[model samples]
Target: MAAVTDAAGNPWFSWDYVQSNASALLAALIQHVELTAASVLIAAVLAIPLGILAYRVSWLTGPILALSSVLYTIPSLGLFAVLAPFLGLYASTVVIGLVLYALLVIVRNTLTGLNQVPVEIRDAARGMGYGKLGLLTRIELPLSLPSIMTGLRIATVSTVAMVTVGSVVGGYGGFGELILEGFRNNFYKAQIMTATIATVLLALVFDLVLALLGRLATPWSRRRAS
Candidate 1:
């Protein structure tokens, strides 16, 4: 295919570039979604319990949030480098790092949501002979649905962005790889723009899906708003 360049003599986005790399782009898109989903799921599993514990034991809250905050501060590439020896260049390294980054948002929001439950509600549940588990599952979790959903949405969007960083760790193909390859191949603008746009679209799509799920989960909130 003939190269497409702008009047400024610089390569620009073209359908030809997209058509040629359709297979690779599709593979990368799938990889990005899989990585983001896996990371968030793992994070939720680990975070929810910790969040509960942090809520029950006030002293644990500070430390738990602190640890996650520190983990979040680690540079993405640096974290990958640290994990490479133990996990090799596999996707596990990326997933683990993403999970760590997501923990702060998930755990904090979980705690916030649970704490937001009215004291009267808790007392009522207790008066009705609800055990601790019942109180948590039926009373707290349902009320906290909105907050937890917010956390999930935030984590999902952030994870989608971070997964691109994983492309730096060879063998972990994602949209980031396309961006990097584009830069490496003399600023192949078409590849770069396509991958970047695809990544943004993915994040927006996930955010919207989560928002819809949140609405479904907490219909009472919508009812109140209306």
Candidate 2:
């Protein structure tokens, strides 16, 4: 049974609920990570390239950035609904929604990091026989890694939370299901516990990973400290 009787006639943590459904819980969490990772990774790949191109071309900057920023203002559910027909009732819609959500931050930060590079340093790279690509790869890319990483970290956290909306469209995975199930069943504690645990744990995990990456990418900042 999903619920059981206690000795005193009060139900406790339903061992059957967890044990019988352990696989479902694991599957849901795994699907959550899969959806989140695919969206974020795709956004990173596409945004970095487009952002770099945007930085290089002054004419493209205003329009491209404005368009991506507009994507951020749209509600997540609305975006999913609009794309659902085309992508169908699956994780593709979720991935597309999340990717759109991530683009503005990623592109803006990439541009910011590239623009923040010192003019004199760039000139020196050119003087040292570096071409545009060489200067970008060796000088601009390394220097900008820290800021880009910051953008990615923010995107990851945001996407992790935002992905809960995916289940609303029938993706059938993630902590969203836990919250939904709890709501439908009037199990407030279940909803609160799963939501809280998923949020806190995901945020902490990503934040620490990004912190380490930031420190590694910008070791010169450490020298300034010591």
Candidate 3:
């Protein structure tokens, strides 16, 4: 392939490069989606219970939130390096790191939403003979759906962006790999632009889908707004 350059002598964008790497791009896109989904779901499972416990035990809340906040602050590359010794360069390292990163958002939002439920509402439920389980499942959870969905939306979008960084873990395929490859082969500006655009588009699409799902789950919120 002849190198195409602009008048400024920089490599110009080429659709041919994107066409040539279409299969790799598709594979990377699928892997990226899978990694994001798995990490978020796993984080939710672990975080929701911790969130509930934190909300119930006032003393524990500070420590729990602190730990998750610290985890979130860890640099992504540094976290991957730390995990590599134990988990190697496998996708699991990426997924586990991402899950930890997601915990702060999920747990904080869960607690916030649950705690926001009015004390009067809880008392009213009890007055009507609602048991502890009934109060949680029927009342608190429903009212907190909006907050939980917001957390999920945030987590999902962030995870999608982060998954690209996982390409550094070796054997991991994501748009990040394409970006790195383009940088390594500086002539391939098309590769860099394609990956960058695709990553942003992926984040936007997932965020919108999650927002729509949030709306569906909390129809009462929409009704109230209208």
Best candidate, lDDT: 1
lDDT of 3 by residue, 115-167 (tens): 99999999999999999889989999899889988898899999988998887
Looking at model 1, residue 73 earns an lDDT score of: 92
**Can you give the TM-score per candidate against the true fold?**
0.95, 0.87, 0.93
Off by more than 4 A, model 2: 1-22
Alpha-carbon RMSD to native, per candidate: 1.9, 4.1, 2.4
- The local distance difference test score of model 3 is 0.88
Worst 10 residues of 3 by lDDT: 2-11
Q: What is candidate 1's lDDT per residue for 29-96, written digit by digit as tens?
A: 98999999999999999999999999989999999999988998999889988888888889888899
Please report, as a residue range, the 10-residue window in candidate 1 with the lowest summed lDDT.
Answer: 1-10
Candidate 1 Cα lDDT to native = 0.91
TM-score preference between candidates 1 and 2, better one: 1
TM-score head-to-head 1 vs 3, winner: 1
- In terms of lDDT, which candidate is stronger, 1 or 3? 1
Q: Please give the ranking of all candidate structures by TM-score, highest first, separated by commas.
A: 1, 3, 2
Q: Assess the local accuracy of residue 139 in candidate 1 as a C-alpha lDDT between 0 and 100.
A: 91
